[model samples]
Target: MMGLENGITDIPYEVHSSEDLGRYLIAARDLMPGDLVLTERPLVFAPKALPDPEACMPCVGCYKPVLTDVGERCAKCGWPVCSGNCPGLRDVRHHAAECEVLSLRPDCVLDNMAEYYRHDALLSLRCLLLQKTDPENWKKLLEMQSHMECRTPGTESYDEADEFVVQYLMNNFINKFDGKLKKDVPESSKAILHRICGIVDTNALEIRLQQGTELLGLYSNTCVMEHSCIPNTKHSFVHSPKDKNDVFKITVKIVVPVVKGSHITTMYSHALWGTQARRQHLKDSKYFACKCQRCSDPTELGTYLSAMKCLGDGNNPCDGIHFPEDPLDDESDWACNKCKVKVSSSQVNMLISQMGEQVDNVQMMGGSVPTLENLLCRLSTFLHPNHYHIYSIKHSLVQLYGRQPNYMSQEYLDKKIKMCNDLINITKTLDPGNARLSLYRSVLQHELHSALVLTSKKANSDGSFKSDEDVKALLVEAKTAIEDALNCLKDDMEETAGKKLYAVIEKTKKEFEKYCKEKQLNI
Candidate 1:
């Protein structure tokens, strides 16, 4: 058995294999919420598959964004690099071995290449080259489960265009390596190249490196954890402060308690997404039909995340949630819980698609308060108040309420406070202990502090404070809220959102203390 490394102990987790599911991770003992479970470094890391037109020139070694106009390029191959003598480029990077091979191959030339073909083959090429230089790491990679045989035309995993790119890498690149590399490579076989591509597609996680660049990282042990719609654990990528540009580690923590022997799983699909959308995305990307509890429940654990508002022409609209007749089948009819009215799956699909487009447009408007409010009002005509679409809009509104220009009024701050509290309640049921929950709680506390301070100031100016006790009470509430916000934000300081919240909370606390001293109240 492969044991946990890096001083990870008392984790209460074990690795197991099954005939049907291959390898998976399970809890060996009872695990509780907020427990640290595991940490790992990637076996192989490469840039993500960027859209052809949207591809930016990131450094080949550390994956840092490097502008083409002034950035350095590799001396031999002319690919993006931090500097000619960069430590990663000189001796330790993946680019060192492939640079010479790419420099000689006629078809491997980088100039005037199409956008789609730029990054599609880079990860596979890196894996193949690793076999020559880092044999042990290559061997570990080969042990991974790659569902290459299942990539058929009729299946959800099929992608004809990507497959063509894999073929090009094998025929035009790998098969034409330099004589030195050719002798080092075991065999210039397309089958091996295909398997490498399949492995990356199946198991790679999107790592958000420093400076906001995203890359694909392959973790040997963490990859074995299965997917769940409502996952028990969450993972975060922590970049090394000593070398922020290149080094990163994945930290997985338990978000919910689990019994001994229960499977330890993480979310592949977003927790906020509707059931149908989440399941469809899993099927298309991961090549699996999810039968998790959330997928099986028609009401989605009574959250009604996918419900549409009934358009009945009667005196009262149908007070019912709409759900699929058979939760597992996409073509199943949808029925109303109260009116017993049925809607075709095709119709529901069309409606959702159209609404999704509108939501995208509103999101693209840069989270303006009026624009989001208008969008929410329009969405309510056809969507339940608690629908994911409406929830998303409200979530955006809460974030923008106090930050936008002309939105810091006392009225607006009170509105923001109420919205934040409401969101916290919903998130407790839908995404408990999520980083988003920490964010929401912090924002709610900050808004509460702002509103209380503003109210206290107005009352004092208007000579409306009946006694000093009233002012003391307001100051106490504001101080407590700021403290709560600080506690919730303690673990998230590395993230941009968390840093911003921390700064705001600290500033507010200082201001509150100053005001308290002015009143001579014991805080």
Candidate 2:
């Protein structure tokens, strides 16, 4: 195997001897905290899904990734005015193109726009976005329509069609499966939509996704990441205003040591559950029987806190199954149900029929919806909180409660934030660059600031701008909330972090000015 030579060949790595693993010398590899393992071009670049886009606002003046719906246009020049008659996204060239398509069949425009945009936007808009970002690609993309143009015969649009296939294949076209040889595909199409198998090996790519997308989750597609029972990385999405891409971008980071040949993994979702529960989730989403080491173990490599003692007497849990007391235990011990013999983990598994009787009483769907609190309770009894299951469960508790501000009271809110703060400490050690964890901490801290405001306001006799002290305290709380939010999100400047900070700054500035204008505020 012609492996990658270390970039620093002049100063080779020092191979050290270790008594452990029965090895005289260990082959050491250097993977710095932020080493770039590999990055392939995006597999697919279709417009991201947008739900309930802002109204027809000219985006040119609004900035690259603005969210407002309406903008005005100057009627004289046929350009954007400001808010109301926002200019078309692009200048005349783009609008002229939109007009041509709308003109082809005026009736089709509305429906086409409706169908395209309802998931979030119209075809005209998607085209505009594509044009704005990659104008060259968009120009070439325009040629695609010629193949489908009304005057043209409905033949295989060889020219326009070729480019579409190429783009599609560039981002997808993995060959992990057997059979269906590349040579068997159409000759003309094969040249561009080439075999994508092993372009970036799936195993290594999973790790790469962890580093690149896990934190911000900025990129979506084959890169749409999933987590694992034993996760190697943690991630979250960051939304930024300065970004050219409109979609919320995700960022990620490694949370553990990933070795060569180890399948680098990230949890698609929370990994609070035991092996069975986690496997069922992947099975549902990815539709693959996880043969990963974690999934392969019935005990989940001893992480299955919920594993029951099928042959136990319910006391202290059980010493060894009492022979006559539990006939099932004896029966499974390579003997009769009433006979006495020790049982194996396999026997403990086969006797699972006894555990299912309780399943009918539980609300979880094949165990899909276990509460993190409950999972935590189980883990508390069976594993350490630092255990992967506990880590996942603890984070879930923080995320669920933190997001739903309306539901919890001051006391509950305090506890939730505290949990997240603790989680922050843990993540700092495990996944220091985990953006979601940072966002989670940011939210909790912001909420805590809210709680502080409420407390201060409660102490005041009346919520009014009457005195300097009242206004000062209120402004302080506002400033603190904005600062906490800004601090947590500052690292993720390219996405939501930037948008949120911009919003906070705007709000804080507006409030500060408003408060100064008032007589004196109490609340």
Candidate 3:
């Protein structure tokens, strides 16, 4: 029998055709929660940069040329520093929290990189750097990620608290550890703790905000984490504020209980469906016939046993799949969630074609607010969660919500901001530049600011609270949001999937930046 010794140590698992997932299965060992999973350095980790890329433009926090393809490494700390005015270098809050780790790992280089791992030679090395910086936290996070993944993904009580903690550590470490202390510790102790955290990204910024795909988890040795239809982990990319650079990291939450040997799975598809649909997805993309308990019920604990996303108005279009249906055509019709009836294929195709064209227009006319929204609603009707175009659509939507030019409503702003928040969790898998997301996030941020302003105005007439404090909060948000979008163009879209996408990202960044600066903002 092919047992653990016979090259089947990890139990039965299917590797997807899209990736070399099985390649990371380097050795046979009993998988455990918080086990030291395989870690490797990527062979190619260059940021997305176009020729004549924008040179370091100091980040708002410290007027330093945030390190990027064109930035520099600090003399004292290997951590990237922007330039002479780089406050990131002199920030006391950061120095003490970061120094010890920097002292221990002399050659430990925090790089802003992109690309795939061609080999495992540097896996141990990278892990060593992680271990050196914060062995306890790194070990804890990997374990948390593995253990929670053993539980189901979406069903568990969602907790943002744990997600934020893990996110704070990894993202900050990568971003050159520039986070201000969460608590108001004494300046001396804060410096010490900051040294412990080291120079890295605060994760205060992210390019992508989506959860890690099952496909990406394969990048780490922790693939043995159990599959949950709904996952606690979310992955994304961020550029270092200290030294401008873009690299992505995966984030996980401790909200779920993870038993050892359970394969961690995320709701790789959209969250709007039941177990059967999610299982079919797992089977198709991941190549695993999921025996997860949810699949046995198919309706996901009766969640979608009798529902439909598009069957209300008696226009049940292409709701279900027709065998031998053409992928290039369309499947944008509705199906009875209860009865399992679908619309005709021809009609579905018609809808899909219209939406696709709508998206193209938004991309073409990036500055148009109305056009972007029209494109978003149409795609939300068909595409699965984290679909590529959703990145483009959501980014546009977030921007529009902020600057409604007129008739800005607080209700829609709340709805749209939450929408971007959820979508960002999914985008972590699809878009790493966070810059791509910056545009959308900016919109949501602006809308939220508008809401606060409206609230302050209402409070003013009623004398409920101080409008100055409220206004400052609102103004800061608007600046942060706008800065996020500008950062993308400034960073030059230097992160992409393949070489072709990389080129496209850089080109878009440059042209967009040029387009904006020329428009001459009042600032």
Index of the highest-TM-score prediction: 1
Compared with the true structure, what per-residue lDDT tens digits does model 3 show for residues 209-244? Answer: 121111111123233334444543333333333434
lDDT of 2 by residue, 332-389 (tens): 2322233244455354434433333333233243332244456456435533344444
Task: Tell me the deviation in Å of residue 252 in model 3.
Answer: 8.9
RMSD versus native structure for model 2: 14.8
- List of clashing residue pairs for candidate 1: none
lDDT of 2 at 180: 33
Candidate 2 lDDT at 225 equals 32
Q: Order of all candidates by TM-score, from best down to worst? A: 1, 2, 3
For each candidate, give its TM-score against the true structure.
Answer: 0.87, 0.38, 0.35
Best by the lDDT measure? 1
Candidate 1 per-residue C-alpha lDDT over 76-112 given as tens digits, one digit per residue, 9 for 90 to 100: 7767666787766754444677676555543333444
- Looking at model 3, residue 19 earns an lDDT score of 38
Error of 2 at 180 (Å): 31
Of 1 and 2, which scores higher on lDDT? 1
Tell me the lDDT of candidate 1: 0.73
